[model samples]
Target: MFRILFYRPEIPPNTGNTIRLAANTGSQLHLVEPLGFAFEDKHLRRAGLDYHDLAYVRVHPDLDSAWHALLPANVYAFSSHADRCYTDVAYQPGDVLFFGPESAGLPEEIQRLPEITDRLRVPMMPGSRSINLANTTAIALYEAWRQRGFAAGG
Candidate 1:
């Protein structure tokens, strides 16, 4: 299964939707702290819509903790500034997909970190800022799953 990492995500609905995404795709969702909204945020609860328990969600105190828990895995950090497209990589199971806060994308330092296998972007029309965080995650997740023949999806 793949793992989704959100670094300091600031939005509630997006995270909520992602929780649901993780549940449906059989992926685990890892969240780095200082989140803008509390876990009890009503918007998040409403967006999650009774799927929270189905999702495998883990909260980390910091990036270091996340690394400690998820290292030795192929980490692909998503950034709009990246030259590589999301589809360029041949993703594998156990790979980690990293995303940044909704307001600003992944920090430059994080994007260039040696821990990350590569930085990638979801292709969009010229001049577009970026895609929705949850949507981008779904695209990458499905692409990776598709590459693996959507194993056990039946």
Candidate 2:
């Protein structure tokens, strides 16, 4: 499945939801360090998740480490500033669907990166705020899966 990378996420519940998503979708969850919440088991339990749910979750020291480990797959950075719609990308399996923190979004440098294949957005009315992090990830992942006929356990 496509990898989900949270670039220095701040909220606990968002991360918690994504952990469950990765487990169910067969996607790998990557978290960049300087996270807002502790990776304590209680946090997972409080969010209706169990220790087993984190089997697909991996924490990286920083973006560079994540990039090195993830091998810099075709990255689709989700941003409100993007001109391309998320659905336009021809997502392949193992494509990295990268999302920034809930509040700040991705850094300015990411937008211009040579390796980032595309920048995308879920269309909303002008001047509206962004979608929930988990929801965005879900939409992107399903779209990718849909492109591949929803292959499971591949």
Candidate 3:
């Protein structure tokens, strides 16, 4: 399974939806701190709708802590600024898919970090801002899983 990392995510519903996505897709969700809302926020709970228990979510105090936990893996940082399409990558199990906050995408410094194997982007029509955070995560996750034969299935 891929590891989904959200750095300083700013929306409750987005993170909530991702929690559900991770549960259903058998991925781990790692959240870097300075989050916009509490894990116990009612909106978040409502959006997650009892799926939280089924999901594996880790909260890191900072980006450094997250790096300490998730390094030594191929990290693909998602950003609209990237030249490469996400599907172009041959994703392997245990790869890390990283995203940034809803308002601001991943910082330039983080995007250029040595740990990031590459920066990837999803296609969109001209004049579009960007896809929803949860939806983007799902797209990347499913593509990677599909390439792996959706492993361990019946």
lDDT of each model, Cα atoms only? 0.93, 0.83, 0.92
- Roughly what TM-score does model 1 have, to 2 decimal places? 0.97
For model 3, name the residue pairs that clash.
none
Candidate 2 Cα misplacement greater than 4 A, ranges: 41-43
**Can you rank all candidates by lDDT, best first?**
1, 3, 2
Per-residue CA lDDT of candidate 2, range 48-111, in tens?
A: 3763454488899888889898875798999988999989988888899899999889887976
Residue pairs with backbone atoms closer than 3 Å in model 2 (clashes)? none
- TM-scores, one per candidate: 0.97, 0.92, 0.97
Where is model 3 poorest over a 10-residue stretch in terms of lDDT?
145-154
Model 1 stretches astray by more than 4 angstroms: none
**Candidate RMSDs in order:** 1.3, 1.7, 1.5
lDDT of 1: 0.93
Clashes of 2: 0
Candidate ranking (TM-score, best to worst): 1, 3, 2
